[model samples]
Target chain A: MSCRIGMDVGGTNVVTGLFDSEGRLLRRSKVRTIKLSSCELIQQLAGQCKEILAAEGVRESELEAVGIGLPGFIQSESGVVSSANLPFNDVPVATRLQQLLGVPVAVENDVKMVVYGEYLHGAGKGYSHVLGLTIGTGMASAWVSDGRLHEGAGGLAGEIGHISFPDISYMCGCGMKGCLETVASTAGIARQARDGLKAGWVGLLAERFPPEIRDELTSHDVWQAYLDGDAFAGQVFQRTANWLSRVLVPSIALLSPDVIIVGGGVAAAGDIFFDSLRSYVSASLHPLYRERLRIVPPSLGDDGGLYGSAEFALKSRKIGLRI
Target chain B: MSCRIGMDVGGTNVVTGLFDSEGRLLRRSKVRTIKLSSCELIQQLAGQCKEILAAEGVRESELEAVGIGLPGFIQSESGVVSSANLPFNDVPVATRLQQLLGVPVAVENDVKMVVYGEYLHGAGKGYSHVLGLTIGTGMASAWVSDGRLHEGAGGLAGEIGHISFPDISYMCGCGMKGCLETVASTAGIARQARDGLKAGWVGLLAERFPPEIRDELTSHDVWQAYLDGDAFAGQVFQRTANWLSRVLVPSIALLSPDVIIVGGGVAAAGDIFFDSLRSYVSASLHPLYRERLRIVPPSLGDDGGLYGSAEFALKSRKIGLRI
Candidate 1:
């Protein structure tokens, strides 16, 4: 009757899963994130966990542990989270959650949790060294080598989004000019289309989205135009791929990972995006590094964090209020 | 009576060192590299090793192992080398040298060897995760995490030289345009000065070296001018620092090493170059990453590879003809 609860807390939503002893999902639930204080958010998350467990007819004593994946600067050892999107600034999430749930809880950066999930159960299942890149509202990456994650000294490793792209003059949100995030993220892709529309290179984007609604146009609109064979949209994706390749070239040279698991919203673009990314990266890499390197999308999809957190909680036997 | 021979084979010179059981340097020797064939080159390296051992009065039986650091693509498992500057094209260096010296031999890439050297005994001592950047003829980097090297899947991790700089139009030796090596290396710095001279911005360089012999201008000449308050030379160094910072920004973001050990010819520029690099990198990095990051010069200087190679050989047991 032993069970575990895995939770993924994001800006808009909180997803929780009830997994049985064998690591199989027994039940799942989703609720809108409460943007109140840290204490209130933890209370809401606890309620969601209890609701999911009850739906599966599981007893509170049968719940062995709970694991969470949070977005932002997460200090794994301290379980402290400081995120721009969440109301967590130096908030000790694991301590509060454990106190409420009466079970041990483990916390990790959402991106890293996704990577661990992929490495353990997805596209990176058999790869000895895996680099997972999450290209969504923001750019983030995580690495798992020899079954252990490398969080660097500050636990801020894989923050490649801030890498400068000298050719770019756009101001990044990080107060730096020309950061890779200025163009590599999903928001960056939409901004590219908007910039083009304003600069008169409109093409199908202007015809479809129009200037009145341009500010609200998403990366999906740009991708739609590219699928419709719009040259300008194609150019935008091409530029994104090239700039991404510039970053990947260094990554490949530095890590030489066997497989690069690319997840997040970008995976929805399918082969068109994958082909462009693979070719651009391959063309720039040395023959020595180009051999045996595979770049693929994650097989776990949105459930990566759920599985990753459940597995992480199950594996970490000595979890307590470390903070 | 236990001793070891450490050899570093470069394009211009072959350096060898004899180390006692306690890893202390007992004697050293240097000779010009033989660029005839792989066989002759291996023979030359073998002779250098033997000469150093004889000078130290260490017999073949007393010499526990011989280790060589070669410049180029090296397969540690296979002990094969392929380099641009050397005559080694898939050469079985460890096997050939072990046969000639009647002792176990270990071979590694020159840059990685230097990094391992620094990690074990120099700037990287006491640091758990260390990143070593060698900026000489070309730019290369290596990482040591948890006291073990991350060689990637292809054993070619840390090849940041070829990472593209989209702003520059210069073609790299690797057939890519605007690689980091195009501007971050000593040769690249000299090339920048020469290109400026050709474009009619010949400041102190023209006054000092003159156009008649400007074709032979080296990074040393550029550094000399910068030391004498030359505005143009200062700009060249600043540009190099900025470009190098662009690369390091990504490196810091991805690796988050406690210390970045900068070595090779660029280290000779001292604080003038180091200060510029540190400031630029700090300016771009997020405060989260900027904290506790130290950029330092290697303490072992030219002897890093020697110590690293000897330590590598002594540590690697069951050595045989790996190739």
Candidate 2:
């Protein structure tokens, strides 16, 4: 049985997994994503592939293909694009990997890969039309209809985070003011918490976080405070939910997907985030749609991206071999 | 050469067209859509089909199939569903039409048909991922990706009009408060103008439309006053554009279509409506997407729905014959 290597490349770490044709994860490895040149990063990734193969006692010839998922605007056809956080721009990722590994390689946006992974093997398994939202440091979404990803005209589809929230005035990293990301993301939550504290808004946060640590309060801290029943934290969380619902409601209206799978750190807050969100979404949805729509958390959790990359590689290899 | 019949059934009219295999309209006919029973509406549509066929001198034997586009939540496979504006609920449109016309019948949502028409023969011809927005009495949108319509799980997709706008408090016809339709549709615009007039907000509307006519002022009157350089009318139009941009900017970020095709009576206001809308949408978009996206008017105008219905019939017929 042929195996493939799937890699999820992020700003902080590179996660690689080995899986067989049926998408069973045989082995896995990870390495820190150091600030290196594009060529160096590619070399490190190839080295990790070799290390995994050696650990598994498999030869390069026995592998079918490799797939990589990373952050960026991906030109899927050429497997090249640029991202602000990455070390390189216009990097031909698939070509470079194929040259080094002597196998076909597939590359796609990381979030899209995660969505594909969920669609193939996780919560989205049985749904033909799936919408996946990942809310972490930033927000991103991907759409899969009829079992294929809708990458859009420029492969920039599903950038839900950058949607302008005309009511807000926060400047976003994407150079736009009042983007949904500024108000709905993990970073956004943390920023709001910090600003509220600075403004002398009294809440349970004062008791939960002392003076020294208060300055470094993150979204996790805010979430913990909310869990501890802090009114301010609860309000912040509610605002995020409101912003998310504003975008999600319209999205549901526009896409009408069978399932909406939400993942990432914020979703890990569990019922604290989802319960109210589900109610808000359901209450706001048209009667015709509210009863049938499913909003749930991703089952695969963090590994979804890796599994998706592997599945994509296997699918692409099969097609390549068929051709 | 085989011909086909296509029908666009709306709340006010039933338009029928005869088209050859190439999607060219050979002949057309229309009849007023009185508030008939479902059976009567079906009979009227069937009668119009026969009238068009006779006018074109095309025999039923030479026709491939018939396609109908109407407003409703469609179960495309069964071609049965309900809509708020339609006189009947759970109407078996295709089954009834097939029985009456003695031919294969395919039915779909009217907006989806218009998008398909635009995709096939209008301004959306060259784009693989197309988004069509029709702003008339209400707002609706449809998406075409990879040459196929993305009909969501329940065919309730593209109902952007019902998306809640939390910032607004206006009640919508859909039994929801602050839906986008309350602020962005033709009715929404008219309501805002009427409300502003009632609130005694002084504007050129008072002069353009005296007290008697003020009570009957429509969206067209608002548009006319805006064109005639009324500040309040312009602000009203700008507010509508703002609300539209709020929804559309996010849609652009999420869908990233090649072009956004705007149609319907509101769009017929020409550059008076589009120029400002285009500027607002552009100014609000992330730089990554703003440069590549095009928002333009539909080339086929009102006939887009008819052509789309006809084209859908031809395509469905070919597939049916293949099966």
lDDT of each: 0.84, 0.83
DockQ agreement of candidate 2 with the native complex: 0.73
Q: What is the TM-score of chain A in candidate 2?
A: 0.95
After superposing all C-alphas onto the true structure, candidate 1 shows an RMSD in angstroms of 3.1
Model 2 chain A lowest lDDT segment of ten: A314-323
Clashing pairs in 2: none
Docking class of 1: medium
Judge candidate 1 at residue A260 and give its lDDT. 96
Which tens-of-lDDT digit does each residue in B1-323 have in candidate 1?
89997888889898898999999989888888755777888888888877877777778789888878877988878888888999988888888888998888888888888888899999999988899988889888888898776778868787888877557788999887878888888988899999888888756788877779988999999999889878888888788878878668777887789899988886678877888899999877777788777999999989999988888877664433342
Cα lDDT, model 1, residue B179: 82
Fraction of native contacts in model 2?
Answer: 0.81
Q: Which segments of candidate 2 are over 4 A away from where they belong?
A: A208-213, A318-323, B211-213, B320-323
**Worst lDDT window (10 residues) for model 1 chain A?**
A314-323
Q: Give the alpha carbon lDDT tens digit for every residue of A122-204 in model 1.
A: 88998889999888888888888888778898788988888765578888887878888889889889988899999897577
Per candidate, native contacts kept equal 0.70, 0.81
Every candidate's DockQ is 0.56, 0.73
